[model samples]
Target: MAVVVGSYSFLFVSTFVAALTYITYQLLSSYLHKWFAMKPVPGPEGTYLFLGDALMFKPKAGEFFRQIVEFTQEFRDLPLFKIWVGPVPFVALFHAETVEKILSNPVHLDKSFAYKFLHPWLGTGLLTSTGQKWRQRRKILTPTFHFSILTDFLLVMNEQAEILVEKLEKKAGKGSFNCFSDVTLCALDIICETAMGKKIHAQSDSESEYVKSVYRMSDIVSLRQRRPWFWPDFIYYYFGQGKEHDSTLKVLHSFTQKVIQERSESMSYGETGSDTNQGQKKRQAFLDMLLKTTDEDGNRLSHQDIQEEVDTFMFEGHDTTAAAMN
Candidate 1:
């Protein structure tokens, strides 16, 4: 019994070490290859061998952004500049021509590596899918955004916009302040209503578990994106920010899944009450339209598929629109 236990322990340690060594070698090799390929690119000098520019980055949001701005200004003359965040290489394009070259290329449709951090929260929805999956999803989702359908969303947009204006008007005569959060919550409310047929009223109640989970999950994903050491699933989930991430993810997924289940059941029973009023058509949310959509093969999307798209819309629409507005 003692010999068997010792053998198992030795085997476990051996396997662990082998995995660690393999990972280290792969990272080192990738760094060396990128270092050589991008050697001509101008970047900050005197970076550490392994740590690179990561040590210079601040954990604070404003400070981190300031550092990035400084870097861009320093390398403004160059079309592009490279930086190493640990073993990962990042190349920032400064010129429109340089950016257009990549953006116009069909081969460059795949999202960057950082988007993988969003997979836990969003799955491979339209925002993150690539290759044939992306094409298929785009086709499946294109009709959902038809002008008529978007017109229905106008009701939601107009209502949320009024609420936002009222909230801002309350602070109009007061001292100067940031309106970003207020705008973001308004956007969240609009997206929630338009996407899921549910009213989270994020502008009114931002303390709700779903609302808080959305922001917390974004923070966790952003932090992991910045830290290369936390890229591995085992390291991230077991060692760094794992418990908080899991809890936040559970809240988000549960809310989305519950809504999806309810919407599906509602559609199955033909319980839509659009015609109950006098000449006022009920606005179908994105979830409502998705429930009735079938793919090219006449097969309906599975529950998981619908959830992915709904969550993707929620993730993609809210923050970006808020940022643009603010």
Candidate 2:
């Protein structure tokens, strides 16, 4: 019995070593192929072999985004340039013709590899989905964003904008202030209300757990994207900010799920009741439209589907719109 156990252990060890070696070889070969293929693309000089341009990426929160914009401007004359983030290659397109070529082709519709970091929080929502799923989802959601349908949410946007103006007015004549956070919070309020039909009041109550989780999650995801070592789930969770990431994700997903459940229940009740409230000019939210939306086969979106789209909107809408507004 002892001999048999020892033999089994030896075999397991040998097999594990062999498997690891094969995987390493395959990955290295793939990276080499990609590197050779992109050799024609111009890049910054003096990039490290293993680290690539990763060391140049600032570790601070917003610096990564700023540096990327700076790099693009620095190489604006080039049609496209390549940057190595560890083994991964990032090709930046500066020419309008090059970008137009990619966008005009349906074959190039898949999102970038960096978007994978958002899968934990967003699932396979419209932002991350590819192939047929993306086409189907886009078809179902196109009507929701139509001019007529979008007009319903104007009230929420205007209300949130007024609140933002009021807050900024108070700070007026006091001193120069960074209004980024204030503007982002107002955008958050508009997005939450229009997307979920739930008032989170982010401007008035930024300390709320849900609000904090949203910001924390964004920071954590951004950090992971810049740090190649954190690409692996095991490394990220055990060695990095795994616990905080998970806890923040729980808070975000919990809030979204709870809101979805409440909205679904209320929608059912509304369908059965009299159309009294329907007579009033009540603002219809994206969630309300999603509940009624159907696919080409007349199939309703699943609960998870609704949640993913809501979460996608919540993430995509606020900060981007705020950035533009600021």
Tally clashing residue pairs in candidate 2. 0
What is each predicted model's overall lDDT from 0 to 1? 0.85, 0.87
Candidate 1 per-residue C-alpha lDDT over 4-112 given as tens digits, one digit per residue, 9 for 90 to 100: 9999999999999999999999988887988788778788886777677777777766567678888889988888888888767789986899999998888987898
Per-residue lDDT of model 2, residues 210-276, tens digit only? 9999999999998888788888899888899988999999999999999888778988888421112
The TM-score of candidate 1 is 0.88
- The best candidate in terms of TM-score: 2
- What TM-score would candidate 2 get against the native? 0.91
Which pairs clash in the backbone of model 1? none
Instruction: Score every model by TM-score.
Output: 0.88, 0.91
